[model samples]
Target: MGGFATGLARVTTATILASSALPWPQPWHSAGNAQARGSGRPITSGPNFFTAEEFAMVRQLCERIYPQDEEGPGADGLGVPLFIDGQLSTPYGYGARWYMHGPFVAGPPEAGYQLPYAPRQLYRLALERLNAFCLENWQKPFVQLSEEVQVDLLTWLEKDALSLGPVPGNVFFELLRANTLEGVFSDPIHGGNHLMKSWYLTGFPGARADFMDWINQEGAAYPFGPVSIPVLPHKRDEQG
Candidate 1:
């Protein structure tokens, strides 16, 4: 595999392992939400949390982290930005499930999510700082930068060479990177995994309840397409 594919494999592997340890809530979808299962339609509505400028920057950032190549469609094509937007509108973005009160001292890496800011706040603060950094260095915003420069900025962020004010650049990079993978591999009802392309790529048997018949066939390639969770539409008001 090429460098991009190798890196993507590592990210995807790590994401899968991490996801298995988390308690994922069922997603609620509305009729107005763009369905990406079989249609592969892009989300046309504006973001719920990110402003136009912030959204544009995030879209470019995701694209750079997982650019389209001969392997398959990348983050932008999978509607990862829309997935992130949807997530930021949910309780997870507000850190509702976490224990927020704290002295907020720096903890070891294993402590996990010691930051005071919620996911939404992290994105807002980080994006603002990142844009300022780009304008200061490149005379433009992140979205306006050339693709090569975008990749360089992302690399710097990943390596902690960049800092986003109160938010560490590496923290923001991991958050964005993990979210991008989730958007690519998650069921379509959650606003990504458009047409189950990632599933096809990895030969993942999605939402199949049971694949026991093939369990005994070691090393056998399971000849089947992926099945996504059924999308049940609810009224916008009823979502509450």
Candidate 2:
């Protein structure tokens, strides 16, 4: 589990770095800021995209992927599901930036994003099929299964043993994993990394304007808590 946690941390860092080049929707940034400010509040609202059942499944799946250990909070604890919900409500989930009109040909792995379904559509379809598969085999939905069984089902999905209609099981798994990592490590303004816990866990100095004082300390641990971008009250209200 230590290795798993370490790998997840590394991937989270990579995702953060990779996302720096991407363009984010203005509404998402605003909404993320609002959500970030209320990080202490429990999520009482329903998901922006997923149904209640689908959201439950996502929560369970993400927890399994990044479970809490001696390290710190897990995916749920870090508000990963909320982050995903926020993302799916944005243009990115609709694949607005992608060239959606296509011949829809089956291409090699090198040909990026060959699927016709957007991220939102893919999750909707895949979760339904995954639940059906779980019921057919285990007489229960994926969310109700034991942790070991859930892990086994995830492995099957990763191996493409389970079919998710038009969306490949492996593709869905990869998407889920990537998004989970993003939620675990993305800036609080983007609605994950609640209280900057991931940054603290990984010893990352998040969004700090200047850290030149500690740059020269070789092999020395920096003694400071991670800082998140502050959300102004007026801006939060404006976004609301």
Candidate 3:
């Protein structure tokens, strides 16, 4: 959305999201350079909020969403659940400067979020609701529940059966699930994208400085950017 209005300078230009008159990207950026190396630091909240059991549950949920396979690494490998924890610790966790004022109404799918609760609130409420449902129905915490029970809970949320207070279950599901994917794929500068697996899959050359020469060359192998980092903690080699 941000790029669409600016029109990619080479072809033309139009500013999108005039909310800020600043340039399309901030000056601190590596710009279009793919050499950007992620320090892989967490940006959101720390180990707070998540009890050990809750964290294990999150890991399990993420693994279910993107299981490990020969095709590529899974959500756990990318540190998505950890990324979620960090996001909840950030200002975004407090609802920040967003337009939280609302005479709320349920709208079409495209109407987007109308609630005031921030991500931290969402997680807090959702996890409680999930645990309540688990205890009421299964007599155990979510983390201790069987994989099938976990799937059932997630399915209920996806289908809007497990309603949390204030926030809609589907809304929480979408927000949490979408954030999970975004962190899994985002430029590592912000956090997540542990090993650039998303870039590798999409052939995204990543934040390269000089696509000027290579873009549109059609099917050229991405240089693997000299900044490649191991996607997993165990695979990480500062030298390799």
Full ranking by lDDT = 2, 1, 3
Candidate 2, residues 1-240: lDDT per residue as tens digits?
Answer: 334434655455645543232222222224433433335223455677888999999998888888877657788878899889889989999999988988898889998888889999999999999999889989998888998888777878889897888889999999999899889877777778776666656655577798789777764555654567776787566435
Model 3: CA > 4 A from native? 1-39, 42-46, 108-110, 216-218, 226-240
* C-alpha lDDT values of all predictions: 0.74, 0.75, 0.60
TM-score list, all predictions: 0.82, 0.83, 0.70
TM-score of 2: 0.83
RMSD to truth, every model: 6.8, 7.3, 11.3
> Mind giving the per-residue lDDT tens digits that candidate 3 earns over 124-229?
7777777777788878877788766666666677799878767678887777677766676666644566656544544444555665675686555444442443
Tens digit per residue, CA lDDT, model 1, 109-178: 8988888999999999999999999899988888888887787788788899998999998999999988
- RMSD, model 2, all Cα superposed? 7.3
Backbone clashes, each candidate: 0, 0, 13
